[model samples]
Target: MSSLPPVTWLQAFEAAARTLSFTRAGEELAVSQSAISQRIRLLEDRLGQALFIRHPRSLSLTEAGQAWLPSIQEAFERLAQGTAEVFGPEPDAPVLIRATPAVQQYWLAPRLCALHRAHPELALRVVTGVWTQDFVGEDVDIEIRYGQGEWPEMVRESLGEERMTPLCTPAMAERLTTPAELAGTTLLHAAGFAVGWPAWLAAAGVEEIERDTHRLWCDTQVMTLRLAAHGCGVALAHRRLMGSAETLVAPFDIECHTAEGFWLTRPARRSLREPARRVWEWLADQTGEQWP
Candidate 1:
């Protein structure tokens, strides 16, 4: 107590040191990036040493910081081990999860609320991703990815069926009552799938639809579907991604199914804690399949 800095200072240091950036450490700690920076500064002042050299674009640990990091890491690891050994596991700790925005907003939100109602103690920290790199960094416990599930070192299970069809606003659906009517309406296209309006149109016998017709191309599925929802255009989206019970009208009986769809993946070697397992199994259960 005589000379030791506060415990938060050491924690901020450890996280910043491990991440090599205060911003990332703040994200991991669920605090502001500035807070992480401030605590480290206070620690530096208390210890009479500069822990990090702050550059315009990066951070580097000073000699004193490098010398102190090992002890800090060991101490935290020991605390975790001791806590697990004596007090058992902290199952309520937020489960870090990364999901495609489509899944997070439309497919999983209500179900998650249901899950929470059932197990009020279980916690989840859901983040959304649209690109391959959006799911990178931060050791997320579970990922809802949109792909064919070929990621190496990940145990994958497909979610829901692979069915897709054209959806639009109710007003638009009323007007474009038939598949042929889509020729005049804007076709919202989201990239990722090999198939799109071309395949769906062919399948629905929607030929004669002009190539010169208006179309909106987007990089993410969520955005394409969003524009369609707001009456901008028709989105060819997976049936499972349409957010709720009554929203996003399917204007046609014709729909297509492919082998590609959302897949839930986690590291093959990592084990889910009790709470995280509950959320994982709950998601798998939503699709009516058991996750390996």
Candidate 2:
């Protein structure tokens, strides 16, 4: 006949064996010392073996108990690890997000303040770059990309679309009365989107202008807009990100849709984690508003 009391009895035995003191084990398990001793006694009786040698001042493990202790400890440890992986404080490791500087500074950064207010425990790491790279073996958990939603082994969701319009300082706006007048002024180019200048020019019906004539170049859209705000030149910027910057003003009554948009990408397998899922949902909600 089999002789095992129950899983709880095994837990009590393991705790008692490791501490070698019923009182301490009881405190660890949130039970009384007498209760702990009783469970151990019951388990020993069922197994027909003395697990511990009780003494007036101390306790010692019997030969049978010594052999069983290691297995009991390993079993408990495995169970604990499994439980934590399934439902516990999700690995306090920082979650990394990859994005361009423009989106980070103008769009994601402001909304993250609200996220911080709501979820104080979540840690965010932002990585800015011009092109997408292999996320495998990288620290990135999520990526906010500007392109068509087409990634090989990752899940993709469109966050928002971008509309390009000519922006300059108020003084520059007054001088540049027509699109053709922009030929003499500096034109800013943001990295990774070379078509912005031509698209704007075509929309404004100005074919005589030369895009390659611009001498100034910036790596990010945010930097280009900043340069324009300081009257350095004119920049084609996304309207959604221009929320309330008073220094930059759009003129010429011309706007065109860019071939690219914002996308949230992550490994399909890693997306199953709770923290990643939560961040994805938050991003989708933030960009759900209709653009003005």
Maximum-TM-score candidate: 1
- In model 1, pairs of residues that clash are none
Q: Which stretches of candidate 2 lie over 4 Å from their true place?
A: 1-90, 134-137, 211-213, 290-292
Taking every candidate in turn, the Cα RMSD to the unseen true structure, in Å, is: 9.8, 10.4
Per residue, candidate 2 scores C-alpha lDDT tens digits across 146-172 of: 877777767788877668888988888
Summarize candidate 1's per-residue lDDT along 1-292 as a digit string, tens digits.
4867788889999999989999999999899999999999899888888999999999999999999999999998888765553433455568878888777777777778888899988777888787877876555778888777888967788775677888888888888767877776799998878778888888888666847468889987788877887889889987755545246878887988777878888766657777778888888777763211
- Report how far residue 182 has shifted in candidate 1, in Å: 1.9
Candidate 1 accuracy as lDDT = 0.80
lDDT of 1 at 261: 78
Lowest lDDT sum, 10 consecutive residues, model 2, at 82-91
Against the hidden reference, what TM-scores do the models get?
0.66, 0.65
